[model samples]
Target: MKNFIIICFLLLVGHQTVNAQKALRVYVVRHAEKLTGDPKEKDPELSPEGSERAQALAKELKGQKIDSIFSTNYKRTKLTGFPLADKIGISIKTYNPDQTKALATQLIENAKGKNILIVGHSNTVLEIIEAFGGEKPVKPLTDDDYDYLFTVTVKGKKVEVKTSRYGASHHTEGGEAKAMKSNK
Candidate 1:
């Protein structure tokens, strides 16, 4: 009886360990700054600083074993997510804004326990966080605020959203996009 009890305890502990090992990470950020040109054109390309910020994003998530990359079907967003996708050898999958809720479910179902990087616009970033059981720090991102990084971590059913920053800020004259390291 003693031996059987010990074996059962070991099995229960091992099962818990395996379940706890599954961690899903979602790194979400807004599209980089765009050039001021062609007011009529809906999709503007990234500015020079935006390109630098993209590289910084790639550097930030370098070896995270990022399995999936997602972006809205737009020039600035795609450009921002490209470097990391290229570095990780994954294609950038585009999701329409209208179907973000569905996409959010698909991401959780498909990614399982891997890392995912999502590039979106200022308006949609908060929605994406809410989709993953994360509370939004701000209701909406302002046009000038491009320095927020929403790091969503999922372990089993528990989800945590930690606000962080990466790359240069889009608000500064220079110097890492001005306060790039801050969570603002």
Candidate 2:
């Protein structure tokens, strides 16, 4: 009876440990290319190319079981995430772009073992990645860099970051996009 009790306790503890290690996958991306040459336009809707990119994003993530979608409250950001949200039958939840830490904390606390999508801007994408304890790109994303997709996996406090691209090539050379990975 004593041996059986110990074995049962060990099994229970092991099961809990496995549950705790379930990975939470987060897909983060900057809003697709926006209209340029407009100084007076404070918030512009996505351009034609941007619209296509948004659709591409939706196609890329479709059938991935995305539990939730979050986007900054901006015309571009919301539009970027809208296609995926509609395809997945989930509404896009707006979040303040400036509140990076708060968003990260909320995601880490409540979004464990779930898939999340975040649509942000060029300036904020790196900040969001770091806030989630994931690796940021070596070079800050420039205004013209719109095809990058950042996949961040969180298992407890451990983070793994993988960078890839989707849609049309934004690079000058027009070569195939490359991918990078980092673990923390």
Task: Evaluate model 2: give its TM-score.
Answer: 0.83
lDDT of each: 0.83, 0.86
Candidate 2: C-alpha RMSD after superposition: 7.3
lDDT by residue for model 1 over 1-184, one digit each (tens)?
Answer: 9999999999999977775668779999999888877888799999998898899999989978888888999999999999988888889999998788898777766666788998999989999888887889655787766667889987767889997777764544331334345676
Show pairs that collide, candidate 1: 168-176, 169-176, 169-177
- Candidate 2 per-residue lDDT, tens place, 1-184, comes to 9999999999999977886788888899999878876979988889999999999999999977999998988899999999999988889999988787898888887777899999999888989889999877548877677888899998998999998888877564443333433565
Task: Please give the lDDT score for candidate 1.
Answer: 0.83
Measure candidate 1: CA RMSD.
Answer: 6.2
Can you list the residue pairs that collide in candidate 2?
A: none
Number of clashes recorded per candidate = 3, 0
